[model samples]
Target: MGSGEHDRILDAALAEADTAGLRGKAVTPFLLGRIVELSGGRSLEVNLDLARNNVRVAAEVAIAWAARR
Candidate 1:
């Protein structure tokens, strides 16, 4: 997906995480995995590094989404 749309999805995933009251390290990967699952399947196999990046991206996107709200 394009960066813009990807960011939008990440934002939505973050919102979902917030609504679900998820915390700690697994939240992002869980959200990311769910996003992938909903879109299709697990295209990218999750790993430590990828999970870490997902967490970062989720946080960034979530913050941006919140700012717009």
Candidate 2:
């Protein structure tokens, strides 16, 4: 999804969570679930892609650092 759409979904989810009085540790899961619902599950797919990309980047960084040492 475009960044604008992603931001809109996140803002809407956060607003709903706030209205529902979600706080502390409860907020993360609530927001995630709301985002998924709001985005028609697209958010979850994006999240998984981001996670995998992060792992790949971390491994690349580690390899580069090791080579320099």
- Local distance difference test scores for all models: 0.74, 0.94
**Number of the top TM-score candidate:** 2
User: After TM-score superposition, what is the CA distance of residue 50 in candidate 2 from its true location, in Å?
Assistant: 1.3
Write one digit per residue (lDDT tens) for candidate 1, span 9-58.
Answer: 67878888888889999696888776786545433544456898999999
Candidate 2: lDDT of 44? 88
lDDT of 1: 0.74
Per-residue error (Å), model 1, residue 50: 10
**Model 2: which ten-residue window has the lowest total lDDT?**
38-47
Off by over 4 Å in 1: 41-69
